[model samples]
Every structure is written in structure tokens, then in C-alpha cells.
Target: MYNKKSREQLLKEYQKETFLRKTVSFYKYCTIKNPQEYRDSLYQSFEQLNIFGRIYVANEGINAQISVPENTFELFLSTINQDPILQAIQLKFAVEDGLSFLKLKVIVKKEIVAYGIKSHEYDMNHTGKHLTPVEYNQSIQEKDSVIVDMRNYYESEVGRFQNAITPDAHFSKELLPMVANQLAGQEDKKIHLYCTGGIRCEKASAYLIQKGFKEVYQLGGGIIQYAQDQKKYGFKSQFIGKNFVFDDRMSERITEHVLAHCHQCGTKADSHKNCANQTCHLLFIQCENCAQNYQDCCSKSCQEFVCLPKEEQLKNREFENKRLTSLKLSTKFRPKLKGLQKNAV
Candidate 1:
């Protein structure tokens, strides 16, 4: 049986252990009839090997970001491949290695990527042509080519291919419409797509094809693999700055170029940090000076709120919720405002 440890217990266990490993991220979109059962089996298999990271299984497919012990990496890969559905799955190793996650969590979700698009919106079978890192580099140089970054604004703000058209949309659901609207008149032009680990672009390219866009192409393995491939062959990297990740590290450098600035002091920085205020845990960029000045909060109000006692903090949240409710302001769109932080940075 798999034991579910509390957060404190898990952190304690992680701190007490020293393991040498490399973290890798990968995803695959394939029909899975019994995601719960599949999730359990994977948990049992990986847990025994001390693998740690997040994974999601869905009826549509699976998406995972995991850290594996370098010594047993071959065994880990083989174990996952033992399942016919996951056999020969393409794994993209992170550009930099660290204990990115402290525990293994296999969750069952409605969708792997969580784009929230209707099933009828696109045909995955007819996705865009896959391009290797070398090929992707060449395509972006073409005069008629449109390089679209299929990721959140914050992700692209840190690092992206030169001349890539990063949409202003914040959420994944808003990307299709924004991209479609921007490229409305150039349906015949060559459009190239890229994302964190290629999973987002998989569905995005398919969506564009369904919208009647011709000559669509996607970076074969997104930025992660592109970084690895560039290093393996000593190719000059076209991607500049850090690659924003959804792990503890938050971001990794693919190039020495720092293209973004801190949100507070406007100093050149590429680091992303979550506001320390638990209730207002806004993800934003802050330099060392701002971090110290603001105490890791996004705003002065958030910093003050975090300084309150726990009981007072809870009471403040209750009052805030009531005030918003009384004002008839909906909270559903709060997540969409995350992109604005990047613009402010």
C-alpha cells in the first residue's frame, strides 16, 4: 500500500535523505480508459524507486514531470515502458538538474494539459509537422514564417525564440482565440509553435490546423529538449534567458541572456518567486533589493497582510471575501490576471 504522508512529514523525509538524481519532464496524449487504475499502478512502481514529482493521468492522456535517481534512471524508464500504453514514450530531461519535487503525486484529472477546450474543437490526429531543434532554428529565420510561443506570457517573458509572437493571453484557454485572431489574415503563411515541453504545442498545433491554417509546424520537443539537443551537439542556442517551469526551481537558464526585469525595481532579472502571503500567493518577479524591501510580497498590502497573526489573517480573508461578494465581483477571472504581472515586470 502507498502511504500518503503529510506535507511536514514529506519535507522532513526529503531533508533527511540525500539522493543523486536527474529530473525529467514528459507527456503523451493517448486514450486511457481507466486513469485511476493506471495512476495507482504508476504510483506503486515509481514510489518504490524513490522517484519524486507530479503526474496527471486522464481519459485523454498523461502528463508528467518527475525526478529519477540517476543510478536507476534506466530502470525507471524501463519500468514505465513495461506498460504497453507508455512504451517508447519520449522523455525530455530538464536542462538543469535538482530536487525539483519533494514527493510523488499521481493525480487523476479531466484533462492532462487543462486547456479546457471542447473535444470537438480539434483533431489531434491532424496536428502540425514536428520539427527538430535544428529545423526549428531554420524555420524561424524564414521571412514568411510566424513563430508563436504556445505558453503563458510569464513563461515566454523569461525566455523564448527570437521573433516569436507570444500572445497576450494569460490562460491556456485564451490562447486559441488570441492566436487565431492575430493570424486571421495570414492563414497560408508558415506558422511555428513551441512550448515548455512540447505538450501544449501538440494540442495548439492541432487546433490551428482545424481552424484552416496551412503549413503549421511545432518544435519537436519544446524548449527542454531543444536545450538538451543544443548542448549535445554544441549548436548555438536561439532561445534566450531562463525557461519558466512549474516546479520548485520555477525557472531554468537556457542562455545567459536576461531579457526580463524585476516587477518592483525594474532591475534586469529573470527569477520568478511566489508572494509569501498565502492568501495572495501571486507569482511575480522581484530583484534582491525589492525582495528584501517588500518581504517577498507582491504589493505593500500583501506584505502587511502577511505580517498579521494567523487568526487575524483568516479573519481578513473572510472580510475580503464578503466585501468582494457584496460588490458582486466575480473571483473566477483572478487567475487570468497572472499574466499582467509579467507585463508589469
Candidate 2:
């Protein structure tokens, strides 16, 4: 009923694997009858293929971010392409690959994206116009066009489309409403929305239309596909910097424009890393120098905590746990990973 293997054990197994894997994400917003049954079917197929990543299935369709073994990718694609519900699904492939996911997770969720909107708020059938990268680039340059980044603040901090409005929100549940409020009174404007993949924009464009916004459009396949298209066809990318992802490879560089600074030294850097200390695993940008200085930890305190002996560490952990527990909610998005006390080498 439960995965008994320790995290260390799982990681060792993952590292030992000789096969290659490719990460990709795909989603759709069609009616899915009996989600549990669909979930089980997906689990069986994915498990057989030794796939790893998070997946969500709901009555409104399925959302998946999986790493498929290179050997089985063709058969896997054929299986998905043959499915009536998932036929012709658009997949967003990762630009570069690393340790993507440790295990497979096929979850039964209420909504795939978790926009927290009522059924009346969005009509999936009436989503915004899907525009290709070329079309999007041209449309955005036109008058009365408003581009919005439909991802979290952390995601957009490192990279975004040129002149796009990034909402100051952490998670999806908070993002949609904040964007709506920010774009108030611009209902007639040509609202263009984008995400890592095109999934978020599907419901977002519909939600905007419901709010009386005229002329909503979305990136045909979002940043991942747009970047690939630009490279393949030899065109300048309107999107700049990295595309923040949820996998271990935090981001995939789209354009070489460094848009973010190192959270530690204030140097120009966009690479994100979780603190080496498992307890204070804060996600923040750290430059190569800081990575060496702080030993891959978020702060001096976290670095020191990691250096403590195993026996003494448990006693110290009791006090550390209380402090972290209290600060957990406040520092969820903007953690103590920001300013550090002069990093000691």
C-alpha cells in the first residue's frame, strides 16, 4: 500500500539505471468519465514502461509530467496517441534532462491545474485562440495587446516573454485571481496568456473571457514548444531567459539573456538549487561562487546545520524544527534563502 524504500535507496536505484529518459508534459481539458478507472489504467501502462513523474487525472481530463525511457518512448507515444481521450495530445519536451523524477505518482485530483474556479467560471470548449510562435510574436506587437505570464512569480522571475505582465503570486490557487485584479478595466484588450506548457492558459483564457475580456489568445504550445520552433526554423525568440520547471532540473535555458541575480551575492545568475540541508530545503538562485562558498546550502545557518554531527544534530534539530515550523508559511515562496550574513568560504 505504501512505498517502503527510503529516499536514499530510491536515489541510488535511479543513479544506477543505465537507460536514458526524456521528460515531457502534456494536458487536456476534455470530459473524463470515471477518473479512478482511468488513473489505474495509466498507472499500469506507466509502471510497465518504468516511467517516473507526477500525473493528475480528473473528470475534466489528465495532466502529466513524465520521464519516459528512451527505449520505450515510441511504444508509449503510440499507446497515448491511440487513446480516444488523449488522441493528438500536445507534449512539451524538456530542453535538457537530468534526474527528473524519482518515482511515478498518478494522483486523482479535483482539477488538473487547481485554478480553484467554479464550472461556470470557465468553459474549456471555448478556450482562447491558440497562436503559433510567429503569430504570437506578431500579435503581441500590435496596439491594445496585453501579454500576461500565467505562471507563479518564482517561475517568471528567471524568464518570461518580452513585456509580459507577471503576477506576484506563489501557487496557481492564488495566481488567477491576482491576474484578474491586475488586468481590471482592460476587458476589451487583446489579452495574451502563457505558461511553461499551454495547459494553464486553457482555463485562464476561458476565465478571462467569462470576465468579459474580449479577444484572448494563448501560445500554441507555450514556451517549451516556442523555443524549439524558434531554434528549428531559425528565428529570434521573443521569450528571454530560462523556463522554470517543477523537476530536479529546475529550469531549461531558452535564451542566453541572464534576467535574474544570484540570491546570495547579487551577481547575475539564474540557476536555482534547493539547500543541501534537507530540513531547510529552500529553493533559491545561487551563483557558482556562492554554490562553492555556501557548499550548496541556502544560507550560512543551513550550511552549519549540515556540518553538525549525527548524534548532536538530532538534539539541535528539535530547536531548529520549531523555528522552521513557525516560519514555514511565511517563507514558502520567499524563504530565508534571500540575504545571507556574509557567506563564509
User: Which structure among the candidates has the greatest TM-score?
Assistant: 2
Regions of candidate 2 where Cα sits further than 4 Å from its true position? 1-4, 328-345
Candidate 1 colliding pairs:
none
Q: Root-mean-square deviation of each candidate, in angstroms?
A: 3.7, 4.6
Q: What is the C-alpha lDDT of each candidate?
A: 0.82, 0.83
Q: lDDT per residue, candidate 1, 146-240, as tens digits?
A: 99998878788889898889887677777888898999998999999998888988898888999999999999989998999899988788898
- Candidate no. 2 TM-score: 0.91
Judging by lDDT against the true structure, name the best candidate: 2
After the best TM-score superposition of candidate 2, give how far the Cα of residue 322 lies from its true spot, in angstroms. Answer: 1.0
- Please give the range of 10 consecutive residues that has the lowest summed lDDT in model 1: 336-345
Candidate 2 colliding pairs: none
Q: How many backbone clashes does every candidate have?
A: 0, 0
What lDDT would candidate 1 get against the real structure? 0.82
